[model samples]
Target: MLLLFVHSKAQTVTGRIVDSEKQSVVMATIALQTLDSINICATTADADGRFVLTADSIPLPFRLIVSSIGYETVMPECASYAVGDVVLATKTNVLGDVVVKSKRPILNVQGDRIVADASSIIKGRIVTCAFDVAKYVPGILCKNDNELSLAGTMSTTVLVNGKVWNGGSVLEYLKTLPAEKVSKVELLYNASPDMHVTGAVINVVLKDNKGRELTGQVKSSYYNNHHNTFQESGSLFYTTPKWSLYSMYTFADAKSISRSQYLSHHTVGNQVYDIDVDARTHSSSLTHAVYTNATYNVSDKSNVSLSYNASFSPKSDTKGRTTNSYFSNSNYTTSGNSYMHNLHLAYVLKQLRLDANYMSYSNDGTQDMNYEKYENPTAYSYWRKQTSDRFNFSADWGFPLWKTARFSLGATYAYSKTGNRQK
Candidate 1:
């Protein structure tokens, strides 16, 4: 009798909703109530369309309803049971899974060369010049003012975004260009091909130009030193998909104060001269630069580009110098002026680049000498002029290695002849 009652109750309760075939239906409709009562409770099915109620203890004559979009409604009551495959006889709908991903840069790898992106996360505040960038890069060193050394060599060929930017010191150049514009600054150790034996090579990669429209920036700054001094500057940039343009101009006026104390002893061949002295110096300079560039898509694999850059450094100084020795003694003074001009041009290819640069720098200054000797000697007043002319040309080639690696080779020839005359 119990087995018969269980079988009868199982037939009364039913559940489940699906599409044609055995696929589950999502969000179907379900209803439940007392078997003989008109009152009912209805709710939407869950994602799986499998609904459950008090099937173990429902009053006799209780009823449950199941229905789905465009499907025949199912009615059963009084006991516990489960049913499925209430497959709809309608058309099927299909969906695809959505995916999310983002891009990032890679760091720390094994290779003979080291690439230091000037814009890496390692960069920090107080990075006002290339020296600050060098501090974070391995195998790069800047020992003193106006000095750029690489690896073990004293002379290095540095390129700014594949272009020869010889207008100023490397550190000054880095300052002129905001660090944000830098994408990577690479240090190539012992340039390959047994012949480049000069200093190591450095390439400063800048951000690429995109967008079909226009964009740029303008900025100015002030700099101060230990002495009461100050300087100011401004710059701008713009770009487009078919062409690009950039122009920057900077100006500085400054003064410096310093004190020095020293003692020395000299013995040369058969002569000896010992001297002690204290000295102070004050100097200033006015400098500025303007640059412009453009590119035209001559073909798909090749493009033509031209650029011009000019800067002026007019230096004037007032120096007071004194000399004291056993054989002769003198107090001297010097005041002077100097200026420089530089120009450049280039053409580029997909795998190669060619460029030429010329510079004419002149220094015409006077060295005034006054003398007071007690050793039976005489001195004369004097002045002098110095001049320098420089020219440079280079070509670079990049070759792909087995479609995975890349090799870049380049050659540069530079000549700077300088002369000084005194009268």
Candidate 2:
């Protein structure tokens, strides 16, 4: 008697789990069940929100059920094999007259950094740009239009996804970033050595667009203060399994008028005199800015990225007039055009990263001033040109040393050249 035994190969299912915001859903449960609802295999998502299920001599048809806390459950049918991304929508519950005395804290300590939930910060508030959200971050102060400080420290560094941003002014770059793209914010008062920063740091983490193919948004704003101001911006994002591209364009036309009065008392040889001066200034500018970034995933743990940013102000003009009680009056007119360009490249492999950046800026302008003292008139004119170029390279590596400690090493190099001419 001859006996022959046949066995079927094991079938494996692999997929990633994410939430509606495209953030990884860790520790999610995954189950493979039969047509009759009998469980065949089960697994849990790993730290990276990936899961795999295998079964020997699996049935012809099966279904996958994915569930997680605070999210809706999803069951997808599979014919032979299942391999893709599964998105889970957040669950909402309606309660009547539910007043809670305690609430969840918005800020949490995560290792050496403080983390703030972006969604919680913007909830019930009208947030247009990332800069607006940054204003709400705890312990942060917007010192000026383009400057941010932490704990009274003026030297603060801003980062995007753990990478230093060298794209002109941080304020302008943040303005181009949509608030909805932010996942969370990390603040480090005493920056780690690996960051290669000397003072406080703010890191903005962006959400992943894994499941979505294309996404875009447009924003327009109008303001009327001393003058009419208009701004328009648009952003586009495209993603594939291994590559992604993002671009943003902004245009602005702004005008401003300011007036000031100064009063002073002067004493010359015991003779007291009072002086009053009034000044008025008007300014206007037109600007265009563009930013683009492209990233390619070499593998699960490694990637390369390139980004470019440019800003051009075609027309900028300022006019001022002053009058004083001492029979002195003056007038000045200034006009200028300025442009900036920045290029950046980066490579990341696990905990090690390398970056290179270059930036160039140029400004050309002319000024004319007229002065009169006691009916004596004088005229002055000057032309000015300024240019600057900067290049920077950095490398950082970080790894865990123990359960509660980490070790980091990094190096940075920078070169700058500037020139200015006035006549």
Clashing pairs in 2: none
What TM-score does prediction 2 earn?
0.71
Candidates' RMSD to native: 28.3, 18.5
Report the C-alpha lDDT of model 1 over 72-94, residue by residue, as the tens digit: 44555544445444554443344
Candidate 1 accuracy as TM-score: 0.58
What are the lDDT figures for the candidates, one per model? Answer: 0.55, 0.78
Give Cα distance to truth, residue 361, candidate 2, Å. Answer: 0.8
| TM-scores, one per candidate | 0.58, 0.71
Question: Can you write out model 2's per-residue Cα lDDT over 270-362, one digit (the tens) per residue?
Answer: 999899999999999999999899999898889999999999998999999999987679999999999999999999999989999999999
Cα deviation at 361, candidate 1, in Å, is: 1.9
Q: Which stretches of candidate 1 lie over 4 Å from their true place?
A: 1-112, 117-119, 122-135, 138-157, 192-197, 212-226, 263-276, 295-301, 323-329, 374-379, 395-398, 401-420
* Ten-residue stretch with the least lDDT total in model 2: 99-108
